[model samples]
Target: TQLLEQSPQFLSIQEGENLTVYCNSSSVFSSLQWYRQEPGEGPVLLVTVVTGGEVKKLKRLTFQFGDARKDSSLHITAAQPGDTGLYLCAGDKSGGSNYKLTFGKGTLLTVNP
Candidate 1:
């Protein structure tokens, strides 16, 4: 099992505030994926970084993958109540044909208006 750790584990912020969450692992991955999940719902894929040192942005959210592909981070420009949910980082340990995804425990974010 891959050891992926997400910092803070939990985050609580007011609406319009900015925040960032991080994911790190000792094992190098072929690709990384970020997902957000709401209560009683499956995680929704937000972004995927297949190349090292890649950066992706979705609206007010920014995602960055480390050059070594061992770490990643997500930053939100302005927190919103609608953005409150569980953020998960997944790493594809086995690339290509044998794709295996290892997931982090996740970071719980609560944005209050």
Candidate 2:
């Protein structure tokens, strides 16, 4: 299996709708970071969850880290055109060559206004 993966790959929703994107991995990670990117721009860190079963909320978005620290999820309470962007989940190993993060291919979310 791929070390890390994201479901749906793509999601399209109308404004005011809700959606959840999932990230999974077979190997455990020391930490995980979620990032969002708009067109032509680099991804901006939304949050980082390092503890098992930890949850973090930001405005309309919520992020959760798996109890095993091997997976995570992002939930958008209400969709908006401004929410359209690329969502990425990255696992941080933080030691030796493992310090580099392994990213999920990415989830492309489009919210129609």
**Residues 2-82, model 1: lDDT tens digits:** 489998799999999999999999999999999999999999999999889999999999999999999999999988899
Candidate 1 accuracy as lDDT: 0.94
Q: Clashing pairs in model 1?
A: none
lDDT of model number 2: 0.92
lDDT of 2 by residue, 9-75 (tens): 9999999999999999888988999999999999999998989999999999999999999899999
Best by TM-score: 1
Give lDDT per model, in order. 0.94, 0.92
RMSD of every prediction: 1.1, 1.6
Clashes of each: 0, 0
Candidate 1 lDDT for residue 5: 96
